[model samples]
Target: MPKAIYAIWWDPNLGPFLGRSYPENDPLTSEEAVVIFMGHGLQQEAKVGYTKLAKGLVVSYLDSPNCIAVLLDENDDPSVVERNLLRLVGRINFNSSKWDAEITRAFLLLQELIAETSGQELLSNPHVTRLVEDMATGRVSALVPRHVLRATAKYPKASDYLGPDEEEVSRLLKDLERAGHLVPKTYGRRVECRQCGGTEVTLELACPSCGSNDIYKVYLVFCPKCGNRTQTVLVDDLTEVRCQQCKQPAKVSELSVIDVELLCKGCGQATNDPKIVLSCANCGKHMTNTDLLGGTGLAYYPA
Candidate 1:
């Protein structure tokens, strides 16, 4: 078990010395460890791993511009400590508002998960380690939230690359939630493309006949002077409304509103209701809104 966890931010000029440390009087110095790790001059070094420290092993990971180091006991498994650190960082980053309180809970969960009642390290199971690693830093964009109970991991970038052990990851996250190690938060539902399961779908109302997104709100007005029933176009500071026919001009308020509808810029079709189209940004597939898969989406943070 690790005694303390430190979330340190590394700066090129300021050396590596910002962020909060847990259990302040620990024997290890996480900031100095981060400085030493960065100074190693290996751009290709593995971002997450464990290394020997002065008193004990330090599990350190580079979280982009910041670093998190955990000081572990001599008898502790280094890989387990590293995995736990990643998981903690995942939680901290996911729910930044409650991070101060979550730091203690994460370390406690890590200690519990590291050793079972029989004193066996769970890190021996490759499935467990992989699941934890994926939960922390999977190939997901920051804006996208990976569903905790999803069957397979989605790869929006690579069309053909299937994720490895995705079911296991999903199962592991659910189990963690049940064990009070994960807090799930829902941010409403999203419709995804049925073919590629891409969530980057745009819900647009377009011309059904032409399939054009260039639809504009149009107001048809009746010009009393010329008796012209034509499309009313607002011009010159929006105070002047002109009829398409007869070039009759009147104040916007003076014209009687006959109909308000969406006019398509492509085929010039005017209708009260526009066609709901779902466009997949990833694959450029156009389909009806019904073709999308709707599900309750969620995100999770360590409890």
Candidate 2:
């Protein structure tokens, strides 16, 4: 099995930038990056190949036109490493502008591969052992939702009990559930993009009247002394509204401020409710909430 995997971005003028690494603490250092660049002759030679270094045998692939990914292992078969690297890279979108997110996903995929390759080692991890022990002892009865929104899909609460990385914890919990150590209960559904099937969907509030996302809450200030209604403004720590008709400033205490409605900037219409639109980050697809695909939201209990 590979000891570490790296995603590196090669720049023509600057050199290599270490994008991400699996087992994050063990990152590919500057010296190693220089060696890889010089040894492979990346500037002048082949874009992808395998090479043996003092650290290990590295199987590299050109993930994108400028990005390279490599798997490092001292004793693993180079052919096997190359094959695994190809399989793992195939699942990632290197062309995406969101480099951080894509690189993180790539590393997570690498972690899964490492876990599968060394299942016993992973199960023996101190954190994993403690989590299992806690569940077995009834200390943690079930892994429930941390928040009402983005519930099972993000597993925000799992980090509190399992580990700092919610995604990693979620993956571990799913592994245990798949292994029959935990029982799963479906309580809700998540919306996913129908085109790309990506779960990273964001909800946008659009004006129902004009179907525009440029909506702002309307706040009106009413001054009884001047019998004027105008927009409120923040002056230092106080709310002040200057009437256009009387040119009199009214303090917050002397005025009745109300949140009238959500006003659309496009059509100048106000409404209490706005249309919810689901947008896919991966494919840039926009659709109504009802048009999205439903995914299961789950809570887990020790079996």
What TM-score should be assigned to candidate 2?
A: 0.54
Worst 10 residues of 1 by lDDT: 153-162
lDDT of 1 at 204: 78
Model 2: per-residue lDDT, tens digit, 61-158?
Answer: 66333445565655665544454455576688777788667766775676566456343654666766676678789887777755333332555445
Poorly placed runs, candidate 1 (over 4 Å): 27-31, 39-41, 94-100, 116-303
Query: Per-residue lDDT tens digits of candidate 1, residues 161-252?
Result: 22344433433444455545456676445455565544565567888789788878788888866887888645456877666787767778
Instruction: Please provide the root mean square deviation of candidate 1 (C-alpha atoms, Å).
Output: 14.4
Question: Which ten contiguous residues of candidate 2 have the minimum total lDDT?
Answer: 147-156
Q: What is the lDDT of residue 277 in candidate 2?
A: 76
